[model samples]
Target chain A: MTEERDPHLARLFAEAPEPQADEAFVDAVRMGMARGRRMDLAGALAMSAAVGLTCVALAGPVAQAVGQVAGQVAPVMAELFDVPGGEILAVAFAGLMAVSAMVLSRVRV
Target chain B: MRPADSLRLSNAPEAQVIALAAAGSDEAFAELVRRRQGSLRALMRRLCGDAALADDLAQQAFLQAWRTLRQLRSPGAFGGWLRQVAVHVWLRHARLVRPPLDPIEDLDAEPAAESPDPAARLDLSAALAQLKPTQRLCIILNYVEGLSHAEVAASTGWPLGAVKSHIARGTARLRRLLSVEVLS
Candidate 1:
């Protein structure tokens, strides 16, 4: 159904005196915003610290797992392709894993 | 910009103020709040039926608006955007702490005694309180906030048909309760 304008109701609202926001109210809101900003900063710092600690705690196990996977895979690759320096490939793969971990840690999402 | 310069921005047009605000000017945002807080608070008061709660909701709305000011694509539409934010804040709060049903009867039992003529304001407030939340919101947004039915639908994210129906039913109820006949 189409809506029709109700001027009487509109007039009642328009004519109703508005409640004023005193200086105290405005100051309170200003303070509230300042507090909110500080909280946001604190939250961001806390998140960053948490992510850093998590990465630090997991770094050892992650590195170990990456090294084991590379140790098992690099020789297979070397044998399949007749490539030398399986040890070098293993170290390179571990380094790549560390860099990826750091990158992911820095990402907010 | 210096602190004093930012205060001067309050005299600037809304679009200019919004632009400055988006650029991280707290004073510009404060100016916007100073200008718009009255109507926002009034709308909240009418919706929530508690002055203190309305003010709290208004502050929350302004804070939310400041955080997401950059998302506002049209600087000219700040008022409408702010109103939308206020409504969302109220809706969220309502969802968390749902009001008991039959608020109208409660208000009717003990009308506002402060007003010399309680019948006038009390009747309207009581009648409004009786409306279902969605119907009350639609009526307030359309009549009180001066939004068209389509604008009310867009703001509330309700279907256009639902908005129309709510307004129609709400208005009929209000008219009957107020004991006033439509002039035209």
Candidate 2:
């Protein structure tokens, strides 16, 4: 049904006071939006820092584990890829890939 | 903001304002807020019955609109789109709390709990607060704003049947309310 279904409602609404277009309300919303953006940035920074600390704490063991894994796989990768610089080049490539993955994940965040 | 940008924002048509806002112009978005605030705020007040709460929800709606502005495909549809946003915000806030009391049958006979403004003390705002949230939603969109039932349904994302039902029930309930000046 349309509003004309009830003329009383239309008349009542028409007689009600109009809400004012207060500049204060606009400013409040703008401030709220800016504050929200700042909060998001602060939250992202805090999360990044927490992740960085965790990575630092685990760096020693993680490096050793990667080193052992590289010893096992580097030669095989080099042979498979048919590279002249065998094991060292394969290990370096793997390390570069891992660093790239980390950077991408951070960027996505 | 640059003086030229501010000038352009104020002088621009609504569709231009929406486009500029979508493209990340703060001044244009502020202009949108300024232009649209009156009606949106009024609708919120009718839905909520408390001036402060209505303003808060209205502000939240604008903030939400800004955040998702890029998703608004049609700039010309911003008024309806913003009403949808405002309705969503009000509904969310309303859902968080049950109505404290069944609105007094004679809603206009007494003062509104939070709204002390004499203009707001009038019958309509108090009567609206008494209606259930969905009922109130349908009434404001359909009756006050003069939307057809299908338009109210579209704006509220309610089924057309449900919108009609709420309007029917709300109107009857308000008619039953004592001391509402319209019926009294």
Question: lDDT tens digits, residues B39-101, model 1?
Answer: 998899889888899899999999999999999999978889999999889878876787653
Which RMSD values do the candidates have, in order? 7.0, 7.5
Looking at model 2, the pairs that clash are none
TM-score, every prediction: 0.74, 0.74
| TM-score of the A-chain for all models | 0.54, 0.56
Worst 10 residues of 2 chain B by lDDT: B100-109
Write the residue-wise lDDT of candidate 2 on A1-109 in tens digits: 5445566666777888878778899999989989988998999999999999988876766666556656766676768567565567767778776775555445544
Error of 2 at B163 (Å): 1.8
Off by over 4 Å in 1: A58-109, B1-3, B99-121, B181-184
Task: Chain B TM-score per candidate, please.
Answer: 0.81, 0.80
lDDT to native, each model: 0.77, 0.77
Interface RMSD of 2: 2.2
For candidate 2, the TM-score of chain A alone relative to the native chain A: 0.56
